[model samples]
Target chain A: MSKKRLPNIIAVTLMFAMILLAGCAAQPSGDLEVFSWWTAGGEAEGLEAMLEVFAEQYPDIVVINATVAGGAGVDARAVLATRMQGGDPPGSFQVHAGHELIDTYVVADQMESITFLYEEEGWLDVYPPDLIEILSYDGEIWSVPVNIHRANVLWYNAGVFTEQGLTPPTTMDDFFAVAEVLEDGGIIPLSLGESWTVVHLFETVLLGSMGPDAYSGLWNGSTDWGSSQVTQALENFDRMLDYVNEDFAALSWDQATQLVIDGTAAMNIMGDWAEGYFKAQGWTPGIEFGWVASPGSSGAFDALSDSFGLPKDAPNRDAAIAWLRVCGSKEGQDAFNPIKGSIPAHTGGNRGLYDQYLQSAMDDFASDAIVPSLMHGAAASPSWQQDIIDAVALFLGGRDVSAFQAALVAAAGDAGY
Target chain B: MRINRDRLIAFLMILPSLVAIAVFVYGFIGWTARSSVSAWEGLLPDYTFTGLTNFIDLFNTPRFQIDIRNTAIFTVLFISTCLILGLVLAVLLDQRIRGEALFRNIYLFPMAISFIVTGVVWRWLLNPATSLERLSGLNLLFHQAGLDFLISKWYTHPSFGIVAIVIPATWQMSGFTMALYLAGIRSIPEELREAARVDGANELVIYRHIVMPMLKAITLSAVIILGHTSLKIFDLVMAITQEGGQGYSADVPALNMWYTTFRALRFGEGAAIAIVILLTVAVLIVPYLVYTFRSEVEA
Candidate 1:
């Protein structure tokens, strides 16, 4: 080859390489990347089942399961923030249904309004009106909620309860009575976990003490934070703390549930996900463990739903819309919720697929007065939720009830309550 | 002309790296400083100037106060323990003992691993309930051996949680400090020690007057490295204690910054924290850099 021809050949090769690299950098038009924090156990399985349904519907589209593993989507949120700020967004991402979606993504204008999709699919008729209200901002729905989790379920060892001749508590008085018996019998009355779980328990206690209407008012500025009822709730929480496991700070929610599973503790207040954890441990629902609507919250469902939304500049917009459609469908809900241990967000979900506990939860969800869960990001903004967590942490350390109430009020003010 | 051309070529060779550092490091820092003074509270970058509010709020928050206290406790304990233990180990190794390589390697192995790995391993080793007790039945052994007093609530201790974190931090870093001291000790001329001994100075006297003063520069370097690390410590705390570590007892500023920025979407507050950390590290490092540069020029 001639020397001049060599330079031309080198230029041609470089151009080809550049084109190949650019092609590699671009996402395939038919590929949908679903980002979430479900990386373990039943949650991961449920996500896979949903993806399988999506894949079956659209054989041409490839689904990318980009799961960032951490307890409560902590790491995944950080990754999503950076990616979105850097002008790259996944096709769709999992977010808690209410203010977590509204305040974090929608207010920031990072989420694309899926009101059109909802209208086209007639999702407004299927999903609960209250949940739709939570997902909407400025008269447009932003997300497609997959499943509803009841945050105020009190799970207990049924055998232990029957052996001790104690009934499931339905009120604070009943709870304390059962606690007294459990403590006298040398068993932990409540199996509390780390900070978030403690926060979760406090929210349930607040719900029980304040009741559903007053509890919802706490987030919406109608309920005075320093009111007598709020004070009573705080005191109730303090009393509940007295009966919790001493090693509560070191354990995760599941580990705390393990205490109940092994009959070391009498009860644990957690979401329906705890049921999934128990089933994963090979424990039957009614025989091995039992659940109530938590003490003083019998007729109330403390609700937090997990939903997926389209990002503003999703690379695969069509695929994402299709995914959302699948998410809201009855078939998808049945396939996902039975495995996820969460009740379907849609009222039309098949009840036969659910276990006994979920069937009851679904029933309660239909007839019961529903209240938002603060710890699970339904009642308040993410900033307010974090502030409450910090305040709760301080409350746990010092047990100063008045100071905690003051902090909550201040945090609410800061979050524009 | 040839010399000028050679200089130009040399400048061209370094231009890419200089530009890269300028844009990536210093430029980003400037941008962060700008963000720190802004009113950006949520996911969107507002950039409206609201000077010092975030910093003022940070100073007022009880959680931030706890972070400062934890950082102070962690820094003092981590550095002092590593230095003292490192010096002792270096001195012992300097005795020219048998199987010296094995001992040295064993001492330095923790340093070879990342802080994240060290954190995870120590998290299990120092767990109050499920770790050593459940796995090896060491707590049971202690109880049977009547050494139950040896067992305590390790990382779970409320007041001393940051101190527990310090143990893992020191474990990963002390080996590096030891290697530094060992090199410093070995580099001291044998003639100085010999002269001191000839003058009827004892071993202790020789070490105090001759060897210790000679190792001053090494100590300063170690302090600067360790101080900066302690100021910006994040991963070890995140892995071991996490955000809710025993009522936020183990929270440091870095962890606080991360939570504020990402979780809460309070970018302004997070940027202020970053600036505070940067200024703190700069307060320690800038003087040393200046001194080193001046000394190099003099030499």
Candidate 2:
């Protein structure tokens, strides 16, 4: 070949080589891209704990965190939807374990079936049956349960309780008596953040006071909304609301939690996640604070578990499956739940790795002293939750309890669940 | 031949911009309009046409109705406030005030910031924890005498949700309006002012009779831009309201459409709401837009 032609041939070969290298670049073997809306307060810290353990366990795998900052996890869901529709699904994304949600994904064949993983790892032998129920859709496990969060725990300042000569109330009557005492003393009995928090506290009291059988009936659409027990639950919520502070509606959860921390409010009826915030603030359980099952609701816990599922046609299917395994594994539970301030899903993991409060939670779970009840994203269909928001807003706007109950029922019916 | 060459050069120069507008603006709009009709909830096209059913549900929704009302109020207030304040500020600045350039830059700086960023900054400014309670805590001797109403809980209360939206919307947009007015004011020929001066017209009189008349085009332009923005105010309210907080007090049409489609997973209804909002905006703006452009062309 001519010298000039030889140079051209070499250049063409280099171009092809560059293209090939770009196409088959050394992508990380376990480059797992996980999505969750955990970019605030204790949630961020909790996520970091999981990442630390994950890195140690799978050194070759890269954990690409796609964290959106929002309290309700709405923004993260929007991003996931857009990405998934664009045919560029994420490796894994956070979702609550529920039949309605999982069924939708399953019907579309949009989720990766993890029944094999569950069977292969013998997860059925360890994880609670209730949790397994939450994780399954159409008789197949499609997601990994991470934490079982009790939504009915009433967090209160222990110092305030002791100062006021109060023990944790065990019944509805006791609760009202103590609430009145706090009210008379000019301390707000409830630190309720306007909308979702009000619903959370209200639902917690309903579940805790009504017990698991009734609570499950209500959630499963078997209990008629017109039933007297349901009406009684509504009345209990109204009674609790009467004890909330005047400034309650305007306050955020963080602000309301601060009120409890500062000993201004006697109690905050919130999910177990609030424990993480308290722990992050250097507060100890049973000293600086304490928790109880909702007043009059004994021996049953309403729980929801946060889990991760792979979207259909996930860009990195293998990596996502690996991450799901880790999420369900003993090490994953050990790393995640300690910082998450919730009980781990893995049965054999050390429950003692958690603080005093979480250990108590673990004890509650093991003794079948708790029932899984949905709060936040897990309790109702998305439509039902939104209607609750609307109804609560109306209720706070001075609508009566009858109106609130009617709206709630109608909204639930409208969601077609 | 010369004119043809000039036209070709001009079209070539603007080809990239024209393509961008067509692809990004018009293309997405067409896509969105199509999506509004279909049952595509999560990403894939569901291809089911529940014609006008989504719209019917959307209109029936108490939340969506409230949003429409809120958006209308916001639009009227925002456009008028921005136009009036902007014109007044421009007139004042055009008086050749001291530090005019600095003030102009300060006024226009909000325009440079994205709406999300503006929402964040304004949220901090208006947040009860950061500003309201902070100010009330100060022991200034004169503080107790007055200005306390500025920190009224009315803005944060559900009944006063519109006030919450208005404050941030005005803060982010008034400056851009001011800049547009300033440019228009500056465009008025010096000879016209000289003629008014010769007739012994005072500043206010001249502004009312002379400068203002000349600024009809600028006012129209300012109102159109501000009106469009007010109609679709989303990020500001989204950042401001917590989930379940005050419910739909500050929920505008766009946010309602978003929640209806995505959060509620009612894509059909969400699409219907979007089309309604789009049609409403178009109905109001198209005629005004035509008039404004025609005047500009004649000028």
lDDT of each: 0.87, 0.74
Per residue, candidate 2 scores C-alpha lDDT tens digits across A1-417 of 788899899999999999899678653475678888888756677788878777775677788998877656777777766776667777888877674346346555678788988897898898888767666667888888887788877889998899899987878888899999998887888888756677777777777657777776776687776677878888888887788755565567777888899887889887888887787689987889989887876677677778888787777777777777788888888887877678887768796688888888887777654454544565566656666766776677554788777877887687564
Which residue runs does candidate 1 get wrong by more than 4 Å? A1-29, B129-145
**How many clashes in each candidate?**
0, 7
Question: Measured by TM-score, how close is model 2 to the native structure?
Answer: 0.86
Q: Compared with the true structure, what per-residue lDDT tens digits does model 1 show for residues A1-417?
A: 889899999999999998999668643348889999998877899999988888787777898999999858878988988898888999899988888888888888898999998888888888777778778789999998899999999999998999899999999999999999999998889998888899999999999998988998998899988799999999999999999876677678888999898888989999998998888889998998999988999889899999999998899888888899999998888889888889999899888898999999999998888888888878888788889989998887678899999998899889776
- For model 2 the local lDDT of residue A79 reads 73
Chain A TM-score of candidate 1 vs. true chain A: 0.91
Query: Per-residue CA lDDT of candidate 1, range B138-224, in tens?
Result: 345566687877665556666667887888899888988999999999999999999988999998998889989999999999999
On residues B1-299, what C-alpha lDDT tens digit does candidate 2 reach at each position?
99999999999999999999999988977877777777665334686765666666667767777777777777887788777777777877998889999999998887788777866665555544323223423222224666554554433455556666687778777888889888988888999989989999988898889888888877777777777777767777766664323645666888777776777666666767777877887976999978868979999
lDDT of 1 at A258: 94
Per-candidate TM-score against the hidden true structure: 0.92, 0.86
